[model samples]
Target: MSITEKAHRRSSRSLKALFGVLFATIVLGVTLAGGMSPATAAETPTPAPAPTEESDFTNTYSIGGVLRNGDEVLEGVDITVEGDGFSETATSDEAGEWEVVVPGKAEYTVTLEVSTLPDGVELRNPDAASSVVTADQWLTTSITRSFPMGEDTRETTGFGAQLLQRLVSGLNFGLLIALAAIGITLIFGTTGLNNFAHGEMVTFGAIVAWIFAVLLGVNIFVAMAIALVFGGAFGWVQDALLWKPLRRKGVKLVQAMIVSIGLAIVLRYLYLYFIGGETKAMNVGLSEAVQLGPVRITVASIISMVISVVVLVLVGLFLTRTRIGKATRAVSDNPSLAAASGIDVDRIIRIVWVIAGALAALAGVMLALYRQVSWDMGFQILLLMFAAVTLGGLGSAYGALVGSIVVGLFVELSTLFIPADLKYAAALVVLILVLLVRPQGILGRRERIG
Candidate 1:
């Protein structure tokens, strides 16, 4: 109330703001510098340290295969993969995994040298020693080729068992999707914008973490934590620089959406410019699988799933119990009324953006762990997020959560009867069917429908 006290409070707030901006700027700079590091680290094309073995290259696309004989993995098998103007050799590790990084998408011939195989291990089919495979561009994780070796009789997993495994896998995927989808819904609800650039937000998280965890050799967990902070900072910056100004300018919803599309294009290409158009992984190798009774999942999958669940639970609590959260819902329901009632609508929207960015970034990190990280990876997931949001009901966060699980399960399980490529189409088909039956979506209130 006193003049000195007011001055002190304002100064403290300014200092805090200054520190926050500094932190955000530093994070952004670190990642941008990382993107440039690879290009600058070498004067010209040169071999990275241990290039033939596990290397510290920023490129992520590869031709990979697993050599196994029924129950036994074949190690030290020399495999060579050659693409246009590119050739690499990889020896199978103890886990039967061998991958040769490729420059980009192209057809390649892969050959397994039988002489290098251990005495007892041999190619099951002499005719299949060499095979040609095609590498897919645009977010294809790894172009996998299979070579069968040796034979000890082991029964194939039953259909029931396979089904259970897929269901669990779908749940794991759904949780991550839920993270991004929930964020999407929050932004859509409060702001009435599709926020297509959100996908880039996802890509940012993965690539940033990839820089720290893989290239810089930082601990994976720490890299992920840093990624989360950057993700939140990204949202804050977007609000302060872009969306808030548009809102103040009385931008039309359609116009604002068009701006997001342009923003998406700019950001995505910027990513490609800095990071190149290759896939990258956040964590090295793979997580060991943990069997849970009838189902098996990787340790990283477990951690990601646990993180998603806990965050969702916290979000639920915040929405239902906290005053700010209740205000958020009120704003989502009707911003003008909430604003008239003394709720800070713009502030609430900014909060929503920050939360959405953090969640989407986490989804991106999880994606890098299981799948491949690429510039357009978030764009791929963005389609599913849209489907989930629409299927859950256009503007409902809880509905988005339920819809994401359904979409994830259907996308994975549909592979049983449909081609894997068609599975995504199948999910969209299901969304169409659901909308036809009940346009409001699962968990959507009746009032949501026209």
Candidate 2:
């Protein structure tokens, strides 16, 4: 054969070898893909991961405030915010501003170091030398907590003026107490359950209002309306999720009461966990105190009293005139008898819960205005609530109204004679006296103990 013909044959063999190598590579790739485990296949990026929730992310929450005495900026003041082995301190800058940035969300103690104050400066209320504030708050841009630095001349007023003021304060306080007492009374009458968690209901209202009025910058009255609606819904939810189910499960009233206590504890802690133990003043603006002779009370107090009275009156009308109200009363009197009379006892009880929740929440909002809203504000007044209920007599709405007023007046007025701290004890003493005189309560009927 010629040299050219030999070269062409060699070229053909090389070309065939290249094609065979390419086919082997393709087959090998297919085999590897087919043999791959699901776990390994998942590693291949076909679908991207979804974005994480805002709560899942860790962001810096700034805890800061200004230290000012009237128009004067007070510098060199040290503020500390501490939580669970983490502590940070910040000194006021030249502009009287101080800030401490913390990681994550948690309840923290924000203390105004009184020792660091200037020689002439002092906290207005020594009792409020330190405040417990939250770190890493959600949906709130401002985390400023202020400590008033001035002399409190509240005690310098004349005796009679103080008395008149106390009376006004008592009236306002009593009305709020009445609102809560009436709710508890209605619930107890219908269900025979001592809902210790009712206080949390109050707190829930206040917190809701705070979220709307303070955090979200909604109007105060609008926030209050939202709070009332939410409060009622919260009550309905409680019955649906917890109380009603337990009732069907044949749980005893005593066990149900215990459950209420546990629920209260859990809710209180949850509030603390989320909102911290801080006292938040819901509305920013302050209403001037109206002077009536020797008496002095805020315009806000008057509005609150008016609102409380109107709501109470409405509640009274509801119980007496409405079909559901009468049904509730009938159920409270005798659940089995009511049920036999073609009344849905569960429905009436649920309505009562809704009313109770709404009323408690309204009271909470007013209380928040009177004294700033706190995580344990409701729990603090739980004793007074029980007292009011007991004083009025069990299962009597009118009695609760009367009892709460009397208790509220006695508590505030007693401060004139007793130490402010001992006033609660004084109120309890009166409750005991009332109980001794009438164990059946002011309005309660005498029922024989089996």
Candidate 3:
């Protein structure tokens, strides 16, 4: 009896000790998860202080652009920017560029003093005497006036000349669409996600460029470069955070597509909130219209078109020739088979996103150049982009290019017959007719049935 009682007492004490330890562990875990003790909380450092108001003034706003008559730069011309309680004047340099900083956000009138002009040269637009510029941020606004060599007279332009002008305009517009559409098609080919939010990427690029080039006064080229890099990074982050996770979870393609639509709505509103509803202009200013045979085109427009064409051609070559480009094509054709063949499927997908983002951003910048930057600018062109993608074939990059050119031409040229407002509608009608006839699109492969 004594031996058994002693053994039982020892066991009871050991059991009590174990239970006491377990209870203490539970209490400690709860405390740590909830909050630190008052003494420890007080010792924690505060977050890094937010930027000060004075720091914001580091970025200054200026008004500037080039003044030219055809190819000749007009130097020594006095350009005056005036507003209530603020005025600044600048002379055009040898390059015909003039710039002057404004006090802050305010409405200012830019006037080209005709008295300061040379004897033979006169402003093309008499009403261009005073251009009212509203500077809401630290941005460089272009106030360019054309100084034609002869007296201002209304000349009747022939139908052929008008058609040629519209054709050039259409080509410029189509090239921009192609840039964005190719990116969309590439992303679709690789991942099979339609990516409705691709339009937001376009908006993002333009906004970022405005912030850097206008707000911070960085060089336009440098700002564009940074925006492109940021675009690529954004693409990577999106794939890593959302698309990759969804794919891992075995989400259906339809669900993913819906998710993209939701994302597009969110991003569109966010852009509106941050960028505001007002249209923002780039610093490139107004380019003088040059006579190109029968067409009169702005120098800026010509340069933009050249850049777009060259870049697109390079992109095409890259897709057909480069190692990564080939890998991208393989993945787009068949992901599982590409993976089985030892390609890094996820890496290829990520690379495609980066490329898509960069291209979309470039397109946004070009769009801003063509029209003023606005919150819904990207969304406005999204339907046209879809038409291009569909007309080209949903998953074919080259097809997107061809389709965008057709859409662009139709949008601009149709204005001759229909109202300019209905040109977009006309393009959609053309898209419908083409699809009805080909079904597989211009460049899409036809599926064979057994």
Name the best candidate (by lDDT): 2
Better of 1 and 2 by TM-score: 1
Q: Write the per-residue lDDT of candidate 3 for residues 339-398, one digit (tens) a residue.
A: 999999999998988989998888887887788688888899999999999999989999
lDDT of 1 by residue, 215-302 (tens): 9988888888999999999999898877886677556678677777867886787777677887775556458888887788888888
Please give each candidate's TM-score: 0.71, 0.67, 0.67
Report the lDDT of model 2 for residue 144: 72
| Local distance difference test scores for all models | 0.84, 0.85, 0.82
For every model shown, the clashing-pair count is: 1, 0, 1
Q: Candidate 2: TM-score? A: 0.67
Off by over 4 Å in 1: 1-154, 284-286, 448-450
Give a tens-digit lDDT track for model 2, residues 306-352: 99999999999998999998998999899999999999999998998
Cα distance off (Å), candidate 3, residue 167: 0.6
* Candidate 2 vs candidate 3, lDDT winner: 2
**Candidate 2: residue 175 Cα off by (Å):** 0.6
Q: Output the worst ten-in-a-row residue range by lDDT, candidate 1.
A: 14-23
